[model samples]
Target: MVNPRSSSSYRLRRSRFVVPPTIYRLALILLAFSVFLFLVSQRQIPVFDRGPSLPQKSSELEERLWDSASGYGYRPCVKPTHKYAGIQKSTGATDHMFSPIENPKSERSSATAKYFLCAFVLMSYTLYCRFSPIFNFLLASSHYICDMVAVARLMNATLIIPQLDKRSFWQDTSTFSDIFDESHFIKALENDVHIVSELPKEMESAPRVRKHFTSWSSASYYEGMSQMWKDYEVIHVPKSDSRLANNDLPVDIQRLRCRAMYYALRFSNPIESLGKKLVERLKSHGPYIALHLRYEKDMLAFTGCTYGLTDIEAGELKILRENTNHWKMKGINSTEQRLGGFCPLTPKEVGVFLHSMGYPSSTWIYIAAGDIYGGETYLSDLRSQFPNLVSKVHTESLATVEELKEFAKHATQTAAIDYIVSIESDVFIPSYTGNMARAVEGHRRFLGHRKTINPDRKGLVKLFDMLEKGELKEDTKFSSLVIDMHKHRQGAPRKRYGSLPGSKGRDRFRTEESFYENPFPECICPTDHH
Candidate 1:
């Protein structure tokens, strides 16, 4: 009952659609057969495929760039880049990528194989798309070529990263990752500090900052660390097991990781921005002493420090008994009191003793320390005792470690020893650090020219011993307590010799005049006094 015209139109539409599809199928099969016949006919295309292309030379500008960063030497602080390219498979650094130097030789073959396998998987998926422009861009951005190039560049030397520099190392993201992952970034840092047992004469002669970054084979150390991964047959410290899903690093490695965390997190303050406030705290045309106090947990746990006592107590603990079976309480004539208030001091008791020394009130004091509350009460007593020299010791006076680190940025930091020695002070003294082999060299460099006494050895032996027993705790805070208490009760002076004020800058808190050593009848205060 359908109209003949409508039925005819439907049949024509179906025929047109069916005929085009069939024709397309037939054409596709014919095209494939023809391509096979063509391949068989022409086995090879004749082009200039005789030899590899000539290698490209690096530009003078590129050479200059590398040279300038390397301090104008053939030996750059950076390692050769080629060693890790096989694993990285990129011409540049990659995201969270690590050098596979954890294993060497055949041991690392499995890892090397895995890298290629990943590349193969990716390549197979994109076989048809490999020649597309979009595909090339993605590959470039993916870091495979860049990483491979970086590894190839590293072939000249085992090293792969840059040296320690505040400005250069942090400027660009690419350079940063390349330099950062070359080795255990923090591997140079050590608890034993025994790496440079026999320092060269050049190092011994260096002063201040120059010594800190001194060239200790400056050639070898960098190269050794760079090649460590490639040469090591297996891991040196330990490896992460499957137990930890998130973190596989062992304890020692975890500790090493903390340094990087600290470096990254550390704040750098501007010289004028924050220094203005700190300088404002100081008085003009007067003797001001800086008392650095550290009460952090790390400072409090040191055994080499003391429990607080007078110099007399330090000199003669058993003899003070006066031969009486019960020789008891004779108020300590503190070492600080012994100084007659000539020098500046630290911690609660040292501050108190300084206050007592300036009883009539002579010098203004700046108390710098952490965990200010730890010494708040003692500082209060000091303020009450000497109100003059003890004018400004308080929680507010303590600069945070953050502040010090910030200051270090503005401050062309030298060795602590050098700074102490450079001061034309009546005395120069440091409590917990400085004057170690590394610091001594710097101190000699900066302060040696000035002839300041760099007494960084104040607690070296004790600090090391404590560090060995895994007891490097409460260092500065404990030392402060002991030193302060000794000054208050024993009348022990800080140091007989120290530099004068205004040697470095008016706002600067270090000087020889502020130095002190307990001057009991005995040469040094006894090592073990609870």
Candidate 2:
């Protein structure tokens, strides 16, 4: 005990300086906090190496901006490799399964398209026949009906059921029902506008105004007509074609036209079933080609194509062209027409074009048209090259004429078959840009811009003329020229504004575009959804 104080000091100094439990925990927590702060300060935190995290709001805005830069809205161009690539279906209940848009809630009430609108005025006599609508191709006639419905909607009038033309070549006495499913048509467009099987008894006696709606009429014209509805109970629309202005119509009307044509318009059950069967039959042999060879007798006579015709046949066509009073151009020069490529491509030319374009001989070519002007004799050349040419006519022959007697009764029905097959084909090539061709091309564009090789007829004609003069060979030079010429016209995606811009005031109606003929990037989208 001699040095107690010194001993205590020595002991205290020797002992380890242990930290308190609370202080130890606090120190560990502080160390972790420092590490976390370091990470937070850095430019990137490597969470799965997915790059810098975006604040949710800024990311969405950036994505939208990127999409806007691309031609269409938010959605990117559909990847070619995606499933259901290029398949287009109607947005109708009967055909919605085939719709390009993936709408899985078919059974759900919310899945259906809806509209809220009041019923408008009803005209007892809309004058379906007084105007004498043009007796055009099936598609053209269908477009007329679409415009008619659209016009009816615009006029705020109840549309009397339109009568199908009985004066056509096939001359089937069947009403609209024979070609299209009537129930489907009414149901499909129920929301857009009021359609009636027949004018109501009360409205039947209503004062009907026999008014002739002007062609390519704009919204103002229809508005004027609506005013007449007060004075006259019904405003009669004599002419159906170009009645509604293409561009001047409201967006709702334009979309209604599309809905009416593509969705509301459905082929009869029998025709639809047969069309699908024929398509499957053709595809069974692998990818086939659908060629709208506009070489029908009327076409040849109209265009004055004496290319591969005999002197008698040429003389006959000339006579037909001259005699036809409706044909504005009487003195059509066949040589000049062919040289300018205004005439339809002959069978031989089609063969050469397809061969040059790398389609093998084994390729299945389906001819989509009424009848070749010269029949088998003319199509022999194409047959010699492709040999696998098939058409609805060919397929129809498979069934006994007795079995298809009712089906064959109407040209419109047969045309329906041709349309379905052509639409379903992997490749569609049209020789001429007539109503049907343009309609199909536009439909294809609306679908997904499937490969519709609208052959550069004018350009090819020049090359062919040079070849005839021995200036070009049938070798790589010819193949290369054909390929290079058709680069743009191969159904590539493009933007389309209604007609050329520059229409002022009411004249703008004149520039109104055809919906089915040039839907372009507007009615179309890269994705399956609207």
Whose TM-score is greatest here?
2
**What are the clashing pairs of model 2?**
none
Per-prediction TM-score: 0.27, 0.73
Error of 2 at 490 (Å): 1.8
Candidate 1 overall lDDT versus native: 0.29
**Model 1 vs. true fold: TM:** 0.27
Backbone clash total for model 1 is 77
lDDT of 1 by residue, 274-388 (tens): 4434444453524344434332222222111223434443444334323333224334343423233311223444433332222123445543333333354445655654454
Identify the runs in model 1 with alpha carbons over 4 angstroms from their true place: 1-272, 283-285, 295-297, 304-360, 385-429, 434-530
Clashes of 2: 0
Highest lDDT scorer = 2
Quality of model 2 by C-alpha lDDT: 0.66
